[model samples]
Target: MEATRLEPRTLVNGDMVAIVSPASWPEESVPAWIARQVESWGLHAVIAPHTLDRRGYLAGSDADRAADLNQAIRDPEIRAVIASVGGCGSFRLVPDVDVDALRADPKMLVGYSDITALHQVWNAAGVPTLHGAIAGAHGDHVRRLLMEDADTVVEADRGALSAELTTSGSVEGRLFGGNLEMLARSVGVVDFDVAGGILLLEINRAAGLGMVDRALTQLRYSGALDGVVGVALGSIDQFAGYEDRGWTIVDTLRDHFDALGVPVLGGLPLGHIEDLVTVPLGTAAVLDVDHGRLTVDSPSGD
Candidate 1:
């Protein structure tokens, strides 16, 4: 299979970044704090006109959300797009986006959780995106990716690599994955290929071992697990009702993934965890399990 490489564009200081709430709009009380943080980064943060517009659980109407994203992607002045927060409306807006236009004018796109839908769209369109921190997670490790050079590797504490496997080999490929549940939902429809690629996954809320097993089963059934070079499991924030369950998430996953004969590393600081590191979605990265690290290389020269 041919590799799809998306070059990283340089972000100039003082550029305008459009902030859109594709998911549920954050509570109005938090926007000011978020806005101040963005301003401190030396960039003028432009909030989407409908960012605060709410419709029940959604940040705004489907059209409104889609329009904001579209406008941001097409506007050259907006060097990057950062999601305000992730809730539940991004998937609804995906179908209405002009994927072709986004492909033609590739730019930085950042978010996690519900923003996984946009990550899928950008990946399919051959554009790289950031699947790390967003507005709320600005102070997290994701800030390192945003401000540092592409080749920089931000180190996390040993505790960050919670679950450890015994593989030392390295594999490099376009990063493609997000919240496990969201990826599962896009199995049939989204153009995601894990073959020969690093698969990064995370789960939020407390879930039982059975739930994790079921989701992994779906990946296997859909052939999404086939040819995956490495698996990086991010923070499994809250487990729903596993207090009495004998099976730990690590044990359950180890039993399943270890048999697959690939490098598996957990305790990554991504997803719902605080101080999450921003990972470049669709960018080529090298996974070194022995060292308990994932290094993202610049795709500019590829």
Candidate 2:
């Protein structure tokens, strides 16, 4: 039997949202900006105790980061938990997260990039999570996704690097996957439901196209990509002009995706890019490559 899908209640005026640093610490002013943004939506924002703490690349020690996240999860007043920024180290806090507590009291967990780690955990726990940048210019867009009741439509951006690469037709399924590196790393180590979903693929600056090739290959061989019905490609930043042995990033991505042979819609502006859109993962999405559009529905309880 399939586990019933769970959707956290949408945000309302005056609801308190926890600003946390479950990954690497954000810029000194990011949390404050995020707080002001939340207030602009008529919502309250609480900066978690460890949001500003920095211990190396991480926001703080794993225990401290996890404590802040767990507190937000268990708190009745916190209607959402939003990561201030995404750098690295979220995977380290996974073991210490109170996923069960979140399952008992579902609320939104929003962020992208490194926060992909926590998104997978939350989505696996049966609640939906949002993938987007927190402090970027798109905060208003993120606000609407969390606060409004409407579907999200992401049209392929012709200007984006991934725009030229896509498969044929359209397919609908739950939207799964995020930062390619994170998803690849999660395989075997972390368990989640990707079966029968549309995989969302995106990447940031990496050493080379080999990193992209390896991540996709790992997903293919590890059976992690099994049962995925379609693919939605997002920003592949800093890889357009890059070439590894004359193979462009697009060439590398097409090589792997061609084998999956699923409907793939590329250039959705929802990844590690500025002017990003907030998208709900662990929910239904229609990926239409022929029409160059992807429509996403928020997760709803069965």
Candidate 3:
């Protein structure tokens, strides 16, 4: 299938950006601080009505979270949608989303971790979204991407980041991937397709080697690994008892993925980490593993 690249909507001064909690609601202090930071960017920040509501582990009921997300996608005035935080529950709201509406009016959709569900949804709908920092991210990180086009290789500090040309040259393809766990859950559901595309993935506290192994196994078993053009591994942050593990996480995965015959780079500063880099999912990008960089092409006619 030919890749469809979506043009990024420019954020004019005074434009509004909706901040919604599609996954988890951040603590009161953090969300408040984030809001102030957004306003400083010259773009108005409109926090969704239920962004602060909490129902156990979720930001709110599934319907409530889904409603805010849907409303943000359809809101013409809102040029971008930033997630509040990512814990869990975003997947529960995916089936309820109106993919057609989102596709009709695509904009910047940014978040990581649990927000992977939305990435998959947008990918299947042929819309490009961003897998990057949420509203709860550090103020500087959020401000950087919103201000202008950013170019930097992001990787976890502990994990190794390597730029090696595994393939003879670079290939441009649509970006598709997110949190390993959330992506694993979408394996055979007909929504996740990794074929002939660049896969950008990262994990968080649940970085047990076994957990990573299981998730990768699921991707391999479900035929999602077939024809994957390249693999970009983002930060796999502090794992519970990760230090106790005898082998480094990157080394373990490297042994497994080496045979895939595609470029695999690590140390992407993404996932549940500070200074996260935003990647536009479903967009065409040139993955130059040889030169150690990924360049997102300006959407056609932009």
Candidate 4:
């Protein structure tokens, strides 16, 4: 966990960035629209061949999706890689990631949700990545980080969130984490140990509080959080059933992590939030729970 020597690569106006579908296929018009956004920023957006392929719930056959991502990772001219969207199928593409290829010529890997699997893969190999959208909410944040390699501070209104926390201390460590369910599934399947790092968790869906409890409990029991010092919670989007039970998702989360005895800061506008603030995974950061601030100590992507 020493500082990653994977020096940041710059993205100029003419640089080519690849948008590949690594999970479920996106709607017909999405990739092109995302490409236009990239193009508007003065970078060439190359939609990877299989970005639109549809194969049941996946973007394409596992091999095809993997080939697209591997080629994008290995391509000398593609300066960055973005997932078209997050869906149920990304874990299936994990085996085809070609980590060695990513290690040799690491580029900026960006996306969230299902993309968390790919982010962990690259981060484990010492390459940093952006846990943000490929477009829309915070696309400019992504563009700025990939282009400027800037330090950032993320804060959110604690009163407006469906999340909660415990403790009142500060935790300093490298920042890492993504979709809560995806992270829970990553245990044993991928190298996602959050030990010695501040875990960032965001949820896109939850059937009920019980399901969230089970997911977090599973992650804890699997030893994936062996030495984790703290957690920074972000968007818990689209979850149901808290209101009817006279509770909140925050209450459920608090009950789950209270025993860990670490600072837990919630209300970060990350993951699937409308005003998403792009965060650099695997970068050094300080989580000040008392003040509710997350300060990125290093230039994201650097």
Top candidate by lDDT: 2
Q: How many pairs of residues collide in each model?
A: 6, 0, 5, 0
Residues 153-269 of candidate 3: C-alpha lDDT, one tens digit per residue: 343333243222133456667778888889988876636666778888777756467777788888877777788888876765465335434765655566657757787655556
**How far out, in Å, is residue 66 in model 1?**
1.0
lDDT per residue for candidate 4 within 1-302, as digits (tens), equals: 45665745768789899999899999999999989988988999999999999989899899999999999988989888888888868888877788887778878787888888888788788888888885555668777887877776887567646444535789898888898888888888887656688988888764776778778998888888878888888877565444537766767777777867788887788777777888888788999988878887543343
Model 4 has an lDDT value of 0.80
Compared with the true structure, the alpha-carbon lDDT of candidate 3 equals: 0.71
Tens digits of lDDT, candidate 1, 145-187: 5554455353434554345433567677767889877777777
User: What count of clashes does model 4 give?
Assistant: 0
Q: Best-fitting candidate, measured by TM-score?
A: 2
Better of 2 and 4 by lDDT: 2
- Please, what is the whole-model Cα lDDT of each candidate in the order they appear? 0.73, 0.84, 0.71, 0.80
- TM-score rank, highest first? 2, 4, 1, 3
Flag regions of model 2 displaced more than 4 Å.
1-4, 300-302
What C-alpha lDDT, on a 0 to 100 scale, does residue 263 get in candidate 4?
A: 85
**Span of ten consecutive residues with least summed lDDT in model 1:** 152-161
Our model 2 lands, by Cα RMSD against the true structure, at: 1.7
